[model samples]
Target: DTAVSQTPKYLVTQMGNDKSIKCEQNLGHDTMYWYKQDSKKFLKIMFSYNNKELIINETVPNRFSPKSPDKAHLNLHINSLELGDSAVYFCASSRGQGNTGELFFGEGSRLTVL
Candidate 1:
């Protein structure tokens, strides 16, 4: 089984539409994060949850929100999606908090906003 998995590996939506990506990790990790990769392939962390608690939240637009029902699951919901939202969203998990642990990333959910 994949350590981390995300639903809808590929997503195509129109502008102003709302969408959500679901993620789950079976690695029993204590920390999880949502990262966005732009067209240029620059990766940036949007949010991080440790043990189901909000730990690191980057300065992303309010349209983007992350919810963690439990330690193993973290979901990203985007409202009023825009063209700038088109990119690859990755779900990753680590054994511990901070940058010391290795991150296991999902294949990535590619979002294309038209």
Candidate 2:
């Protein structure tokens, strides 16, 4: 079974649209994260939730929101999507609070805006 999975693996739309990506993890982990990969393949953390509590927000735009209903799920919502927002969104999870272990990453959801 897939340890981490995100819906709508591919998204295409015009600018100023609103979109949401859903993620679920079956690994029974306590920490989950949302990461964005730009066109140059640079990965950066956008948000992180530990045990359903927001732990990290990497100065992302207010239009970008992350919701974690529980420890095993984290969802991303973007309002008024811009061309610059087009990138691959990845969902990841870890077993603990610190970076002492491996992070399990999802396949990623590619968002394209024209």
Candidate 3:
């Protein structure tokens, strides 16, 4: 089963708390990525990793962290979550960075921090 899967499709919590979401893909692909889609429907690349090496996006905040236990798994941890953090977080995968259109995406983990 070489498909992307993420846990906790929805998460609701108060501001300034800690949360974590998990993602996994059996695609055997070398690269995995995290993307954030805000309320305005803008899809932004967050982080990408290949072979346990982090290829981070400078725009992303340090409060957000990506942990890749292996090639098939990547987990996200958010500390002191803020209200503005509320949005749809997606886990995606590609063979490489030049990865083009329609990346394999998880259903999405919606976090609502109030």
Candidate 4:
């Protein structure tokens, strides 16, 4: 079984549309995160949740929301998507908050806003 999974690997929509990506992990981790990869392949952390509690918010727009129903799931919701928001969103899970250990990442969800 896949340790981490996200739905709708590819999404194509016009600007101003709303979209969401769901993620789940079975690695029995207590922390989950949402990272965005821009066209230049720069990875940036958008949000981080530990045990369903918000921890890190990296100056992300209010339109971007990270919801974690449980320790195993973290879903990303984008409101009024813009062209600049087009990027690959990756979901990851780690053992504990601020742990330097390896992160288990799910296959990214590519969002294209035209």
Off by over 4 Å in 2: none
Candidates sorted on lDDT, descending: 1, 2, 4, 3
TM-score of each: 0.97, 0.97, 0.92, 0.97
Better of 1 and 4 by lDDT: 1
CA lDDT of each candidate?
Answer: 0.95, 0.94, 0.88, 0.93
Model 3, range 1-114, lDDT digits (tens) per residue?
639999999999999999999999988777888998999989888988886678876487899989998988999999999999999999998775554545799889999999
Residues 60-91 of candidate 4 have per-residue lDDT tens digits of 99999889999999999999999999999999
| Better by lDDT, candidate 2 or 1 | 1
The residue ranges of model 4 lying beyond 4 angstroms of the native Cα positions read none
lDDT of prediction 1? 0.95
Displacement of the residue 11 alpha carbon in candidate 2, Å: 0.4
**Candidate 1 collision pairs:** none
Please list the residue runs of candidate 1 whose C-alpha ends up more than 4 Å from where it truly belongs after superposition: none
Error in Å for residue 49 of model 4: 0.4
- TM-score (C-alpha, index-matched) for candidate 3: 0.92
